[model samples]
Every structure is written in structure tokens, then in C-alpha cells.
Target: MSEKNQRAHDLRMYFTGFGLAVTLTALSFLTAILQPFGPVGLFATLAVLAIAQVVVHFRFFLHIDLSRQAREDLQLILFTGLLIAIMVAGTIWILGDLMTRMM
Candidate 1:
């Protein structure tokens, strides 16, 4: 594609991402305020929206796709996700242990 076309495409993608992010954020806040769902359902809905927002951010803003050129970036993100999961799990485990010991 020509330079102009490529620029236009990028601009369109950025706007689309922005719209999606805003919509997701608004829905999350609305869900919290409106309390449309029960406690468990509310959390689940928010979690799903949050994950979708992350995906949109990665695909649009970060330009991290499944293409060969983006493989390294994908690996980095996956590794970061793994480390965060481990840390969260460990913290929860420690807290649970403390609670059990206290009881």
C-alpha cells in the first residue's frame, strides 16, 4: 500500500481502539453503579471487559500482532503475564496460610 493509505489505516485503527476502550470503561463503571448483576456475576463481567480492553490495547496501541515481526514482543508480553500470575498466586497463598494459622 502507499504511504497515504497506510497512514489512513493506522489512524482509523487508533480511533477504533479509542472508541472500544472508552466503551469498555464506561460499561465497567456503569456496571458498578447500576449493579445490574449479582456480586459474582458483576465481578465476572468486569473481568471479561478488562481482558478485552487489554487485547484491544495490545492489538491497536501497541501494534503487537501474531505476525512474525511481532513474535519477540508477544513473547515478552507472555512472560510478563506469567510473572504477574505467579506473584499474585504466591501472595494469595501466603495470605491463606496466615489466615489458617491464625484460626
Candidate 2:
């Protein structure tokens, strides 16, 4: 393909991915408002959808692949996950303890 055609094709793919992400995000918000499922189910579904959207954005927009730097990318993702978990757990623990003490 010509260079211009290739660039246009890439742009189209990017826009398609972006449209999907936006649709998924809007659906998430709609679900939150409608509450078609219970709170737990709704939240779970939303979380999964959001994670999927993140993956889609990474794959399509960021163009990070498992070719060479896969190991480093995976390590970074894992470390970020660990940090998020620790922060969430610590917040819950400290808040729960504080509430108990206050009571």
C-alpha cells in the first residue's frame, strides 16, 4: 500500500478502537444509572468492562506488544497492581481500625 493509504488505515483503526472504548464507557455509565443488576453484579461487570477497555486502549493506541519488551511491560503492570492492592488494603485497614477506635 502507499504511505498515505497506510497512514489512513492506521488512523481508521485507531478511531475504531477509540469509538469502541467510548461506547463501552458509555454503557458502563448507563448500567450504573439503570442498575439492571444488583450493586455487586453491576460493579463487577463495570470493573471487567473497564479493564477490557484499558487493554483495548493499550493494544490499539499504545501499540505495546509481547514481542521484545513484553517482560518489562508485564513487570511494570504487575508492580502497579501490587501497589494498588497495598494502597487499597492499607486504606481499608486503617479506616476500619480508626472507626472501631472512635466507636
Candidate 3:
């Protein structure tokens, strides 16, 4: 295909991805409005939906895939996840210990 055609195709794909992301975000907001369930249940559902939206945005908008640079991408994602886990765990542990000492 010509360069112009390729650019147009990419633009179309980007718009499609944007539309899907917007739809998912709207749905997530609507789901957040449900009040029949308890706060815990609502919060859990909202959290799950928000995470799903994030993954969708990453996969479609960012065009990240395992098919290309699979190992490197996987390693990067794993390392990032591990770092986040360590940070969160350490913060919680230290805060909990401090709270115990204070009481």
C-alpha cells in the first residue's frame, strides 16, 4: 500500500480503539453507580472493571503484544509487577508495625 493509505489505515485503527476504550470507561462508570449491593461488593466490582479497562487500553491502544519481543516484554512486565508488590507489601508491613507500636 502507499504511504498515505497506510497512514489512513493506522488512523482508522486508532479511532476504533479509542471508541472501544470510551465505551468501556462509560460502562465502568455506570457499573459504579449501582447501590443495591454493599460498599465492599461495589468497590470490588468497580476495581475489577477498572483493571479490565486498563488492560483493554494497553492491549488495543498501546499495541503491546506478546507476539513481538515476547521475552523482553514479559520480563519487563514481571519485574514491574514484582517491584509494585514489594513496595506495597513493605509499606503495609512498616505501617502496621508502627501502628502496633503506637498502640
Q: Scored by CA lDDT, what does every candidate get?
A: 0.96, 0.89, 0.79
Q: Which of 1 and 3 is ahead in lDDT? A: 1
Estimate, for each residue in 1-103, the C-alpha lDDT of model 2 and write its tens digit: 9999999999987998899899989989999999999989998989999998998798778775677867698678779989999999999999999999999
Model 1, stretches more than 4 Å misplaced?
none
Q: Which has the greatest TM-score?
A: 1
Evaluate residue 22 in candidate 2 and report its C-alpha lDDT on the 0 to 100 scale: 94
Better structure of 1 and 2 per TM-score: 1
Q: Cα lDDT for residue 45, model 1? A: 94
Runs of candidate 3 with Cα error greater than 4 angstroms are 1-5, 96-103
Candidate 1: lDDT of 76? 95
Which 10-residue span in candidate 2 carries the lowest summed lDDT? 62-71
Error of 1 at 103 (Å): 5.1
Q: Please give, for residues 1-103, the per-residue lDDT of candidate 3 as tens digits.
A: 9999999987987787788778877876777676656788778877887777777776677766678666677678779989999999999999999999999
- Considering every candidate listed, which one attains the maximal lDDT? 1
TM-scores for all candidates: the values are 0.91, 0.75, 0.70
Tell me the lDDT of candidate 2. Answer: 0.89
